[model samples]
Target: MTDSSPLDDNAFSHIMADPALAGSACSLAVACSGGPDSMALAFLLSRWCRDNGRRLTALVVDHRLRQESAREAETVGARLAALGVRVAILVREGPKLTRDLQNQARLARYGLMLSWCREQGAGDLFLGHHLDDQAETFLLRLARGSGVDGLSAMSPIEMRGGIRLVRPLLDIPKTRLVATLEQAGQAFVQDPSNLSDHFTRNRLRRLMPTLAEEGMDARRLADTAKHLSRARQSLEFYTSQHLNRSGRLYPHGFVRLERATFLEAPEEIRLRSLSKLVSALGGADYPPRFDRLQRLMKRLEADADGAGTLSGCQLLVRGGRIWLAREPSAVSGPVPLEGVGSFIWDRRFRIMLSATKKWPKETDFFIGALGIDGWRQWQNSGREISGFSILPAFVRRGIPALWRGDKLVCPLSTQKSDHWQDHGIEEIHLIAGELFGKTAFSSLNMRTM
Candidate 1:
């Protein structure tokens, strides 16, 4: 808690000791913005990586929202380079921002950074979200009427697309970060946008002092969020257990739930189970609204054979079970593939196209859902597909299929790897979304970090 002390090795090792990072002796990357928070983090990581005999890189994302963004990115690169850390300046390209500027920029920033990590073979990406950021996030989600999960704020470690997002400084104070930079004689830049009242975060930050006077200090707010995070962890554990017991997740990216068994669980578990089923099946980035989920739950309780749709997923009560599948109408349009390449269709399936001797050079190929028309074609063809015939009709409608315009090239059936090879595709590796591997809930280890 000392104001002027620099980040010590013990504090830094707490995060490095994480199980996710233990085997990740590969290079590490940090998102640097030239701000005190990120700069201090870069300084600490450079030293740690050097001592640990691992490489470290600083990734500066130039969002280009402001005219000086590019220059600031270069300045950050220069500073990190001086600290003996390799630097990569990533520029945000394509499409002009028109609305929801902050959110859009944030998404773009992460997209650029994560893509870099994947390309560079870095398995861990460190961030500089400190105690104040957690407190601000808590207030922001609270004002928006967030549920327990949302109010829990940021996690200390998050796994996204094979990359470990490690926030070692989440429990550290911003003042300490600034003091660290000062103590090291390191210079940092202040982003002008942060001072603007036009953003909600800035407004909330300005109100922090006043709120602290009213006894809702950053430490108290962050501690409350930590407690809620533990509660969310407990809820997630039960939700996972309930889902495993009551649901059967298929490789086709749909889930079948025993209606009575699912409904027999506690109401909170039921809601969370539904959320997980729909979110993963529909490939949605966020969960559906809590209010809408509650309404759906009530309807399911009242009507045993009810059919409902929410967040791009359809829920049908058929026979004695509940079926969750992507809504046919919400399925993404065909993705054109020129030749041998891998593509993610509807975010649910990974489709890889490999060229064979029979692969036609003049033909155009695409991947899309089978839909009603394709389903009919499949049915009438009398192909007697082993697995296709057994799938529920609603589930069949959303199955990923290979297409040449209107002609159904091939159905990406789970049991038909040889079938795809016959169509000049050597392999198509398809993994259903992470339906079963629900991550354990985590919070910052305050005693260590």
Candidate 2:
């Protein structure tokens, strides 16, 4: 490997020593775009992996938005192959391109890349984002008047989609990457879109030289991001502690929060906690807007005894506690429970059905949300569950139940048998793992370079 390469032996050594690669060394996938930055990364990583006895794979995502994408991917593959690195190209397939091209492209790119890494059993996915990109991101967020979390910009390591995503070159500059490629006599593709003003990133990039002359260089902006990132980390730590002490997650995509304790926390922690709850219970990809969340938090803490929905989740203030549940509209499914077995219903609750040996009869059932008629019939049955009346109808309707042709088989958790010992469907484990698993915001996991 060339000593002048952006990611030289010393750079790679430093990255390897960090927490990003703390675990036992395994296979890794490096995302490359055939650009100067990514190519330089691939070159250095290939040599490092070889010397360290670790396997490295070069992954390229071809957007296919351009006519030359296929050819470009092939060229990149051949170049990496010459360096003794295995290459895999995933093309963006299906659907005609539309508006919001940049955002859509990024989502598609990451989604595909993460899926590939999981399928390949790669330990970590390395990205080529560097100081220049981090600087641009910071400025873009700054122009939008973003908060400290946004200004912190990109992180050196992130846990996304159950994969470890590491950006080892964040401290290096774009010029260094270009210089590395030049010194090695390697060819790199330059996408014309980088010069187009239609994209905000491109517009900001065009002004970078002018800003640098005025003392707003990438190094300075990136340093600011690091400072804000440190602050964000501190907030994240407290946010986690606050949630654990004040809020408790419940089964079937619900959370039980101690209202008094939640409202007493600092405003930022309060907002962050509420955002975490809504996103987790709602199964929302992104949290609600900050201002909306701020208003909603105030209303919930002070006056929102009424029913309302935010981030596709239903909010109910019951007595002195705040209950967050998935909006019935957000969850729907009538999965057939084949015999005595456990099954996931509505992507929110895991329901298990079982019959005792004393029963000795096969039970057929269909699992679904307890509908309006089911709730009414259940009420008329004179089975008074304590505190059930305080629940909103929408929240009650989402309770999973088993049906056998107009017959109510147990509402949510239990299906009791005639004999106490022979409890039919003994213990339905109503699990809400997915909702609670990602309660913490992703930004919290971000570690700045």
Candidate 3:
């Protein structure tokens, strides 16, 4: 590791100047693990928050993967608390997974931390992912034959679950973080797992030295990632413009694309636009395989009046418009809605219960898709079906519905007449995560040197 100087407030102050962060309140949160990197971040944020007259909280997540994990969490809390930083210890409790332990742990950690941020009214979350982490991620993705977007590595800023995840240390090296801690005479813990070769990252870490001997180093790899990031940014900017010009996202969780507008775009833009539409409407965490996307594009060009399905979404072209809607067969099975609180069902709808209202104690409610059976019942009952006549029959059947046993209680629709006053429903929003209408593609330019 190269000798580096300790970081100061100036290293983090520029993050506050971002216009995207202007909407956030005067409170910030940081993820700390009691390690040199996170510990240094927590200390730096503590002083910065104090000087800026803002509130800061350090969140430590206990994955409970090891026997000492819980105690380690408390130890992290103590260290942050001693630095005059508020600390919250979040525990991940559930059955342990035997496969993909590291990936599972990461998902669980973010789940707990983001939930806490929403509860505490913190809009921005700071993470200590330094240059080495970005370099490792680049090499890993490159090995996997990832495209430009994946190989661009991590961003300095990202929006997750409506929270701004800020990584101000992406340009800083791990040695600088260690130096920062040593300059302040602070003690930090090292995670033993980092040294184990069982994990893919640790294996890559070992190879880094050998690769550096041949003129491939961390700084060079990270710089290549930044260069690719700019190219990715340009592609995303044009893709966003194409999506906005060619499609309309309906409140009923469907998209209508102008047939000619969609087909006329360049091949790359068309693939990207289709990928975004499917991922958002299908609520899939990742985009479909590139080959699958390419194949689907070819089919769309061949068949003007055909239907195809991918990533839990159905794409159909009829009457010169391409209709993208949720695949009814792929809809999540019924989920029990037991309490008077907000819940996200099927990752596509948000159902918020009225805290002031209570339901009958003897009844149980469930949220599921308005399948053909539910639509038949609604139609047979002579309930104003004309209000939903504008939407396609298949699209209407896939919308969210409330059920009491087998009886359909409410079918959420785009019509203005639907209400849940009797059931104490406060609000329902179509919240397909990262859907076309919900968000546009964005990027920020960052200098690594």
Most accurate candidate by lDDT: 3
Estimate TM-scores for all models: 0.76, 0.70, 0.76
Q: Tell me how far the alpha carbon of residue 216 in candidate 2 is from the true structure, in angstroms, after superposition.
A: 1.7
**Better candidate by lDDT, 1 or 2:** 1
Mind giving the per-residue lDDT tens digits that candidate 1 earns over 386-426? Answer: 56676677788887887878978667754446656666555
Higher-ranked by lDDT: 2 or 3: 3
Against the unseen true structure, what C-alpha lDDT does each candidate score? 0.78, 0.74, 0.79
The candidate 3 region of ten consecutive residues with least summed lDDT is 440-449
List clashing residue pairs in candidate 2. Answer: none
The C-alpha RMSD in Å for every predicted model, in order, reads 6.7, 7.9, 6.4
Candidate 3, residue 337: lDDT: 62
The candidates, ranked best first by lDDT, are 3, 1, 2
RMSD of 2: 7.9
Tens-place lDDT digits, model 3, residues 43-100: 8878878977889999999988888889999988988888999999999989975688
